[model samples]
Target chain A: MSENSGSTSTNIFVAKLSSYIDLSIEEHQVIEELTQNSMAFDEGQDIIFESEKNSSAYLLQSGWAIRYKIVPDGGRQIISYLLPGDIFGFRESLFELSDDSVQALTPVIVHCIPAENIAEICDSHTNLSLAFTWARAREQAILTEHIVRLGRRNAYERLGHLLLELLHRLQLVEKAGNSDYFLPLTQEVLADTLGLSIVHVNRTLRKLRNDLMIELDPKTRRLRILDVDALSEATGYDQSFLDQNEKPSRSPQDAIGFEEK
Target chain B: MSENSGSTSTNIFVAKLSSYIDLSIEEHQVIEELTQNSMAFDEGQDIIFESEKNSSAYLLQSGWAIRYKIVPDGGRQIISYLLPGDIFGFRESLFELSDDSVQALTPVIVHCIPAENIAEICDSHTNLSLAFTWARAREQAILTEHIVRLGRRNAYERLGHLLLELLHRLQLVEKAGNSDYFLPLTQEVLADTLGLSIVHVNRTLRKLRNDLMIELDPKTRRLRILDVDALSEATGYDQSFLDQNEKPSRSPQDAIGFEEK
Candidate 1:
């Protein structure tokens, strides 16, 4: 998707921020200056480099991306996935250059806000600073849950949890239907995210399909959750975390420019 | 360490919170009420339980603790370790009954402040609310780092990262010397934390020992990092995330209560 084609005139990012706290006209102007002319990435592109110093943070407009680290043995572990309206690459940049890389999992659009602007915002606006803190804390909670999944849950349970989480997040920005959502992921990509072998991922997918738990149509890139209750039970995921009352202003389609791909 | 020890008479909890924001006399009195008659736990005692509702957030007065979750198959994953003056179990309680457990890794004292009191403070004191937000965000950042470590890094790298993190945290609370820290963990516990087998943990520890990266005296429960540069190089850990400048008034030792154990 071309970034310019999907760019909204409504200042959805500012609108999103307003949901947390009211911003003055001057502060909004400052944010616009901070975000103006930020670059965007195509699907499967690298946004941040591993082991490189970073001076900016990206706000997701549309599509999906992942923050991950590569091991010496050529293994990749996806630490977290960024969805529409999600902000990433800031926590690392806030301290120093990130040790991990963020890659676009789908055709993605992002607002490249300068790190200096973020620091300024934190210094000037206590509310914005608190919002940033809330965002980071939520990120940490997700990671802790992931640790539990990786450390304790089996492959099937982990996959179930991942699906439930994605669906819930999609619902947050109104991207998901009542019982379904589009999951723009390949088996290989899923393997990387879930820390499973491709074969294992394929097997689990088949099992899920056979049990009428989920239906994925690769041709249309649509995911139909046939048994969400069962899946949630298996995953032990409660939707409360996903229903955090914070929503980004842009639609998932607008955020990712999914149609352009 | 008994809860009624003379040294524990001075409330480190209030002092720690004041580091984030200057609490008023009334606010200090409120905090004292919340923490009244809190108990201490010996090493290996559970602070909060899985599937139980805990109304209080703990301020670590002394020693170490861990937040962990258990799987149906009985495997455990230690999500994050709590140091002196660190708070845990409150955020989870804010939403629902606790979904995980907190346990003492060492004999520890903690001031149990009711979650309701904190919520009241946040509602009244904007600065305190901001401080709470920052604390939560910091916790999230740590969890995100752990996800990257466990999902991507090798056993040795994971071990290195874990040790560096523990030592860095210990140093923050002044529990450790300049270059050395006491790690009161066994190979089995380390294996569980790293999601590796005990055999793998032992082999990795031996490799690290042989490489002159670290020296572990299991008998003395002491860990001497021989080469900080090599350790950071191996773990990709940057120390900036450990910054506590916002609350510099509270000594890492006093705020975190490293001496309480």
Candidate 2:
């Protein structure tokens, strides 16, 4: 397990799980051992392919990965991005065939946890099972937000909303600064995700730069959100979905009606 | 438990769970007890609200419901339409407050299973816990498909795609004909869901009707897919994601690439 020597104890998986429940020392040890035995992939590599039998769940220990589906006629749709600490192959665990393919967007380190290990862990540890469920719920929440962005927002709003999403997600791993983060995704990938053409993505990005809402340095693949307030205002972006406040009781005066509670 | 007189043995929740796992007689009895006492809501009633602490998960026993997020200054995004057998408020069980609001689209009967009851069932029963996890995983798969529709398809494709989705889902409960299903959603709801304006939605529906692809009777709110193969072909609709094919020993020759696994 020494392969991941530099970053096992303080991994993003722990940070993410800690958002849902307190981990025991043994659980942390399991996590460290789980991550230490990982495989490495280069940028643009295909880690898992669509329709493949997914016998293991891949944990993104570092770098970026994306889940995408290709059309019969050659078009492609990028569904979700796997950030550090993010887990993929969950759907495969539930069902049989893989519905989409996973690709590495940057040089990535991934720990492949076989299904038997998960069963053993989940069977023996109730807290870990609950944490896994919580993680899946969070993923569902994120996907719900993505659907709203794709189905309701315009181009500029979509771009800003995505940037805000990235910022908040990166914040969980303490990777984001006040306004900047290294985003390795290409404009092509962004276009695929945003349901826009590459040219349109370029133009919208230029508009954001012109309006001082964001600064994307193509050479360095660095994104600096110039005016966070303005970007948020432009898109009506909110971060409530990312909150993991799982406590149960609150005021009954939450007033369940047409208004959001 | 006498309130559930007619369909105690073959309830939707049990049926849905039985799709993924075998439920013993005791588990079935538990589900029947859980659903016997239910509350009814009229059409247009809010069942759960966003940000309100969710105390119980609601099981839709009859009619339709939707999960929607109301944007600032008034705009509603319909994220998911809940069918008769569908469950809501699972997010609340994992997290503290609701992330979006659930509203009844038609007169509905819902059974609220308190969190403690769920805890009791899941703690004592491993299979039930696994079935619960399976249900949530299916929801995630549905959301993944929705993201693809919103981000990759055009308005016509989106509408056709959604119709096909309903047809397949309704078929699960023996509520759909060869190519027809009762869809109670209005054009406004469809517009909101497809990320198109009301007028645009109307135009798109008219085109589909003209193309002899669909027949939507406004008065009856019944949708008939006159040409199922063509609609699926035109829209690239696939239903593999919704299948519960959990048998693991498939030929690993499922294609691999820059896609999802």
Candidate 3:
């Protein structure tokens, strides 16, 4: 375990969790104790292994990660991407054991919370229990939406939906900047996440760029949405799911600048 | 609308709701009034259209249903499935309006609970509120699992896992018999649910049958698991998730012949 070498301990992730429900000073002290010493992983590092006896949940302090599973016959599926402030591996540990694994997508910093302490916290605080329930429910909702995307949507729609979802979640943690967001994803990872071939993902991305809907700068890892409306129309993602309180700035017509497919 | 015929009024679906939380005589009277006349749909009938302004939630009195959305390119993705004693279309009324449609997958009888009445009930009973919260969380969990399935697993594994999931949910209502369960689904629907082509589904089903794992009697809509061990291995479904207590079963091996894939 290594200490996080940063000046900001009270970052957006911590701030967001506190907004949902307050923690007393003693509770904060416990949280510090739980995550006083944490680990950092470079890109593409596996944090949680499939069918492993994992007993800790992680709080994403910085960078990105993904939870996924590998199937027989050498196929890989990226279940979901975990952004800063997102909680991962909690649901899997709630029952029997983890059936999937978590991998770092970028140089990631994580605050590890022991499962036993989480259980104790839930027992003591009703609000914490409610928060845990909400967090799990939200995680499930994301999974459900992913099922829809994988099972039904086309590659173009899937990519568009994926971008919109990332943007929405990023906005929740105040990481999104205007229509542009930092997307530290490689084409290979995108293909794995969307269950498409790398060649296919590249072709589709070219198409999206040609349509003037989005711009991706691989070197800078910046994704700029030129037309949110066009993207939303293509993806069928209503920004209402982004945050219950924050209304979308641009209308569907103005956002994407393209006709709904 | 037609009245709940004969003793079906005392069905598990109706009884389970009241068991979780108290309903006053008036509340019970209201429930009776709401369900006194309800509608039944055969398999594959659309029960709730996407984005419709219906302010009623359907209670599953019998059979199964699926909530889903159709993509622009004629692809259908099933978001979640509703089993007997399950409720659907309630979140639309509770939160914002729904963005998805729901359809019956088997001959289903449903009692429509009005949104206004549900709100009144929630305001009156704290237990009902908690139960409602739990219900929503559970629904979200199902969706999350769907996401994981869609984002990660392969066609064969997805299909097997989906079948196992349906079987487990059906067992809760005692609708599953031995190794056989009624599955009124076509290859097209299965393809949509699993994010595969109908041809692929057919091929996968044949593979399972050839492996001496499962047999599907299409004419009778009956599915027979020939080898529970093989089936579980193919699906990677843990029987513990099916336990009603939300805890893994004590004797998981006896509960089901599940072997991780």
Candidate 4:
């Protein structure tokens, strides 16, 4: 692994996983090796297509992507965001075909870990395996939140809730400041994600700005949640699902209790 | 395990998992023991409440449930349905608290597998562990589809798509016949699930019946999709995500290949 790539690509991952469990030097080395080789996709390019037989799981080293599907009428539903330090393709390992396609919303870089390597890693590295499980659970929680966002929330709550989520998720990987992140999404993208029209998304953004809930710089594509606690209270955005309080043990032998040994 | 409960409960799970990979006699026994002791909940009872510290994963032995969350405005959003043979709560193992609450839609029975037992089982039993992983992947796929349903599809498509999904998922565990099942859900439940109002859901169901796409008997609480192919095509309901075609190898030693030994 080149020292430059190792420091850049693997840092986001190590930062994310370190919150769950303290990694040993060997574990850190394994992650660095796993993410050394990388591939890049330009903005608007398809990273992984739907129904494809993908044999490897990918680690998103940098940039932004979306996992999405198209309805019969050609309407797209953005399933979830694939941010830095996020893992993908692994979920497709046991499936016959990929359900949703992933696309790069911005210039994106990733490291592919073949299925065999994933299985081997999980079998040998208990700490890494547990971290993967934790990641999956976190992803599920986010999807559940998204479902609720679309199913119940109005345009304003939906937009605010989503921004809050991005801010917190990006903050975890040091991709954002205390309450701001580089949000390279078009109003159309936000519309597709929030189940609204572009006009509606635009109106909602204006309302949020007028209401002092958020600030979005169109040129820089950066968003800042001015009052996160108030917006969270107004929108029912709970960060507890994304935050881990107790450090789980690295091995199954010591996982019985909820404390790190 | 009593022979009667064993035949009914474990059979569904065995039937579901058997479609993915053939289980050894010992694996069947393990499932049987895991489900032998179960707790029952009456209709309208909370199976697992939101924010509850859950220490055990659950196996749904019989009846139906819904995983849902309430918005700040008291609006409820049903995230996903928990059917017989479905395993849950394990997803909560890594999270500090449950993100959503699970409620019994009918008189429900579930077996609790403690967190420690889950860790030990996955550590020792590679096949069962893989099966769990497969189940998690399938659940994630379902959630992804739900997001698409909510975000992209109209009321007609959403209602139709969800019914097709339930039909296929229920059929996987022998809980449904060729094209019909006992659907014990009210219009309110349907409204919460499909992101529509009760009046809208009722109107849509009537429209579906009028169009000869479905037959829902209110008296018996049974639903029959007259032509699944037509409905699926119309609603963009793809069963490929729920259906398993490839039998993955049970052991990681042999998982490198696609086919089962």
Candidate 5:
């Protein structure tokens, strides 16, 4: 059951934040109001580009977007995907130019807020800043895990781990007891993201389907995990990185003198 | 030519920060003072552990450290490397638990600064905050590139790209007009980082060395790029990701209403 208790549109990103930390009523109101100012985009459009002078960031009110980089050979690498309730462009508050691009993978609705407004909110609301910071930490952590997936896991493990990861993140935003979710990505996109050939991704999916571990519905673009635990086991998927605590429950042996993980 | 008029200690990290943006005199002094409060570590020591309650972060004043995650199966994935002048631990100001560990790759010296101090500096200095934020952005971008390496590049391309990367980063701190650098990593460590078997790593190294694109003196732990241009071309090693600007120059098609790059 969703923990939110109001208009679902405004509550989505807030509910997602709640999964990371608690927010005060005022903070909730700020995000809810931010959600009210939204825009829609159809699939396969670049929302941001390599050197955009974007003064505003965005909150995904609906649908999906992806961060990607185009290499010298004209190859595109999808850096990260943005789901509803995910915030984007806050980092530009620190820098002037955009380093990468964002393209909508599906029809998306984004809640736009100028960087100055975000800074304004952050200056007055410590909790809001903390919540946003938590979001960024998770984003960095997610990128770290993706690196591991690319460097270590085989194709089968990579596919399983990726699907489960998407499932878990999607659940945090709009999961409603369904083992299935819409993933509006073509096999080519999957190949690009997973560093596999389209043929390899297809073969891996076929194997997973044949083994009854997952079901893919291309017609509706829906993905259902027949067995989450099995997929997790097959991939040695560690969830701790995905679930970051707001405060320390248990400290590690060494405290403050290492590099970013 | 070295770009230092006074001492190398203060300018090491400053030089690094200068790669993206310029720093004011006050900011320079702040980092210099931070270096005065330094600590030493022996090789193979964990500076931060998997769930550490670190209230401070460190700057690599000397030697090298790596950020890594240990799986339940006892496998370790090195997320990123900390070269001299690189800072660590500031992210914990946002979250409680340390998601990964930092271990000294060599006998190392680090300038430790409490997270609060860094925060205080950022609160007062906009330029300093931009520097720190740039560091984090670069870190995230580094992880993203590693993911691409793992997902797409073959072993040859991965090793070539990684070496070029390390060389480029090392150049920022200490180039001495030499095309060679010290990389005190064993074949085992390379195997772990690149997701290859030790034998495979050895084979790749031998091939690169044999082809005269690169040279490795195993006993000296010295690596030399015989032809940086050829290696870059052979592997399609793009440096754009590593060289992130503090702001935009030419500008993207859409300015403010887009997503993070």
Candidate 6:
């Protein structure tokens, strides 16, 4: 598919990065140009494979994907979810190979930014550079949170915490409305992500429904938190970790060590 | 303590970075100068506090530390271990806050690099910039491995995998011998790190010993793996995630979008 200027594919990215740094009209146009060409992957397709040398970075334009790895016993562990506007396949910038693979959770579209372009783009556009750095840092923070959830929280808390996190992240890209989003994860997927059994995940979801904390419809694939505040409090989910409002005061030039013009 | 040009403290860092990219003698001296000044922290001291606005990054000069967060129920989860030659506290470069706290597991010494210095240094020295980027990516890889260990591995695999990881990391800095090191973690710390109960961790450690894969001296706090290959095979621990020998062939200038003079 081809995207024109101001298309939703590019707008979502601009909207997400805009939260970290203000971009000029020209900068927005540049981003749109970067995403003008697109690639598509069907559901259940491996966008990236383990041990592969991926020389380009990808921007997820639409749909969802998961970065995951399998253990010796063939148990899959999802490291993180890639929502719309998320960036992946960039880890090869330093490490020439990837140990974990990324698979599309749904039909997906992406924009490719060749590895060589990454350095040039960041050099010419300091604001976009900082925004990309912000995205990587944000991804790290999310992974750290996931570590905490897996290491400390119980099954109930893990499920609630993940749901709340997805809500906030999806909301950033305008993919979710008030406390609701079209969740595509099945119980088996949730079990793999949360390190729980499928039966346990189903039972926990039922408990959440019974407690009136969330409403999830399997057929519609819609998930809604009945009370965002209560679920957050119950799960000790702190959204501040994902906050993007507190931008550094320095100009992009100063931020990236360039003298202001 | 004051460090000279060739001190082990700085050499460890030089050694670690050299594995990623070769550094010129002048570049090595620059690193030495940057780490000349240092701060010390006692065991259990918080090097960084959650929610604190830390304006500097640190080079871990000596001793071990842990990045961790406390759950709402007061359960602690160790995010990742901060060993010598590690860099941290610089997330402030993008986001203005830190959500995870770092605590010294042993008496620690670290060299501080102010956040502002990071941008300036990276802009001025392209090689150093790439080295720092490599470090951050390596840390991310380590965290991903931790997630897989916690989410997919059993108690035996988790403990074995962690030990092998620590051994390899410590060896890179010369803190470990052929297959062993001074393990500073108590059973409680292991429990928090591995997401297991203290009793379970203790049992797993014993199983490893009984299986002729390792030896541990509680009094000396020394741990030695009798057969690194055997343990790695059993646990599916792949050390390639921590490998630093693969260097990109592109000039440092090209890697960071700079023209060669």
Over A1-261, each residue of candidate 2 has an lDDT whose tens digit, in order, gives: 123434565677776776556666567667777887778888888888876777687788889889888875577888888898888786577566347889989888888889878877876655666667776777888888889898888899998899999998888777788789999988899999999999999999999999988888889988999888888889988887887655322222431212112
Per-residue lDDT for A1-261 in model 5, tens only?
112222443367666665555556667778787766567677887777777777687887778889887766677778888887788877655564347788888877777778768767766665666666666777887887887787777899888898888888887666523578888889999888988889999999999999899999999988999988888898888776776655431122322222222
In model 2, how large is the Cα lDDT of residue A160? 89
lDDT per model vs. reference: 0.71, 0.79, 0.69, 0.84, 0.74, 0.84
Error of 6 at A251 (Å): 3.4
Q: Highest DockQ: which candidate?
A: 4
Error of 2 at B215 (Å): 1.5
Q: Kindly report which residue stretches of model 6 are placed more than 4 angstroms away from their true locations once superposed.
A: A1-10, A249-261, B1-10, B249-261
Candidate 6 lDDT score relative to the true structure: 0.84
Interface RMSD of each: 4.8, 2.2, 4.6, 1.4, 2.9, 1.5
Segments in model 4 whose C-alpha atoms lie over 4 Å from true places: A1-10, A252-261, B1-10, B252-261
Q: Tell me the deviation in Å of residue A82 in model 4.
A: 0.9
What lDDT tens digits, residue by residue, belong to model 5 across residues B1-261?
111223343457766665555556666677777676557778998888777778676777778889887765677788889888787767765685457888999988776777668656766665666666777767777787787777667899889999998998877677423578988999888888988989999999999999999988889888999999999998878776666554431122322221121
Pairs in steric clash, model 6 = none
What would the DockQ be for model 6?
0.64
Kindly report the TM-score of the first chain in candidate 2: 0.89
Q: What's the best-to-worst order under lDDT? A: 4, 6, 2, 5, 1, 3
Model 3 chain A poorest 10 in a row by lDDT: A246-255
* Model 1 C-alpha lDDT per residue in residues A137-184, reported as the tens digit of each score: 566667777898776677898898999988887776667898899898
lDDT of 3 by residue, B1-261 (tens): 245543454656435544344444444545555566567888778888876667677778887788887766666887778888887776655333246788888788888878778755654544444445546645644564566567667788888888887877776567897677998889988888878889999999999888887889999999988877678777765654344343232223323232221
Better of 3 and 6 by lDDT: 6
Compared to the true structure, candidate 4 yields what TM-score?
0.93
Model 2 stretches with alpha carbons more than 4 Å out: A1-9, A246-261, B1-9, B247-261
Model 6: per-residue lDDT, tens digit, B70-148?
8888889999999998988766555753578999999888888888788878766767877777777888899999999
Model 2 DockQ, alpha carbons vs. true complex: 0.45
Cα displacement (angstroms), candidate 4, residue B205, comes to 1.3
**Model 1 RMSD vs true structure:** 7.7
